[model samples]
Target: MDEIVKQSLVKWPNVPSCTGWLLLDRRGNWRMRDEAAQASGAAGVAIRHEALLGFINRNYEVDERGQWFFQNGPQRVYVELGYTPWVVRLSVDVDSALALHDQGGGGFEPAAVFVDEDGGILFADRAQPARIAVLHDHDLEIFSDHATLADHDGSLSGEFHWNAQLALPLQGIRRDDVAARFGFVASPAALA
Candidate 1:
């Protein structure tokens, strides 16, 4: 977090949180959602300002409830996630090892990799399974490289075997169960 943002919080402590006003799109773009755009179920306008993007990234954090938000000075602008909490892209450093660059602006190596029945690739942290991310569809080749088809009863599912200790379940886990199983509420608006 930025020091200026911290000081702003101390100086003006009562700013109400703003939800449904900002969104992090599936392609890792920052968007500003207005009332009209939200009501019409339209995707918000993408924010292209580099400075603002940097500021948001610097102040971004997840609450105890797993709701990620950008602290805009005194106000907390809750982000509407298009997918998982972290949206990742394939990293540039492909020679050393396959890597992922999280939209949150960091890189990490997953302890295990999992592929859902629908071909969604999920990366699980060694320490925290809840800290998972679905790989963007743009990088489907990576998914192909890491996963193999498995027979779960009669249902065929893609299974990723990265290591011995981290094994994805034999049966396919449904998309609806993902949020609950991973300890995150996909739509925080429903809670409000």
Candidate 2:
């Protein structure tokens, strides 16, 4: 949390939370959902301002109920998730080693990999498995190059080669069951 945001919260502790106004899309884009977009059930406009994006990322947090929100100084602006809470992309570090980074530029080590029925790849945080992130679609080809899939007794199994030294087993997951299995709310607006 930002120090300025904390001070604002203490100064105005009764600000009501706003929902259905902001969204985090599957491709890691932060969208602004205005009344027109909300009424028509659209994805809204993607926010491209760099500084504003940074501020939102810095204030992003989750409540005990697994509802993700951004503290905009005083008011809590609840985020409507298009998929998983985190949208991750694969990148090569200075050592030319594979690394995982979220949309907000925060890095996390992947402990487990899951392939959904829709062919989407997701990574579970090594330090906190409950933190699931969907791999950015553009990185699918790179991910496929480092992954191996096999069939065993009519079921699918695989392994993601992190490098010459390590491989993590990949599991199968159903798209619809992701929220319940991983403990996150995809649509906080519906709950609200």
Best by lDDT: 2
Q: Rate the local accuracy (lDDT) of all candidates.
A: 0.73, 0.90
Q: Which residue runs does candidate 2 get wrong by more than 4 Å?
A: 93-95, 151-156
lDDT of 2: 0.90
The window of 10 residues in a row where model 2 has the poorest summed lDDT is 149-158
- The residue-level lDDT of candidate 1 at 27 comes to 75
Q: Model 1: runs farther than 4 Å from truth?
A: 92-96, 150-171
- Model 2 residue 47 lDDT? 99
- Tell me the deviation in Å of residue 155 in model 1: 5.0
Cα-based TM-score, every candidate:
0.84, 0.94
Writing each residue's lDDT as its tens digit, candidate 2 over 1-192 gives 999999999999999999999999999999999999999989999999999999999999998888899999999999999899999999766876898899999997888899887778999986654689999999988787788988776655789998657798989999899889888787888987
Among these predicted structures, which one has the highest TM-score? 2
How high a TM-score does candidate 1 get? 0.84
lDDT of 1 by residue, 65-183 (tens): 87878999999988887767777776435353556777766875676565566757667665554477777789877556655766656555755544334445434557677777777
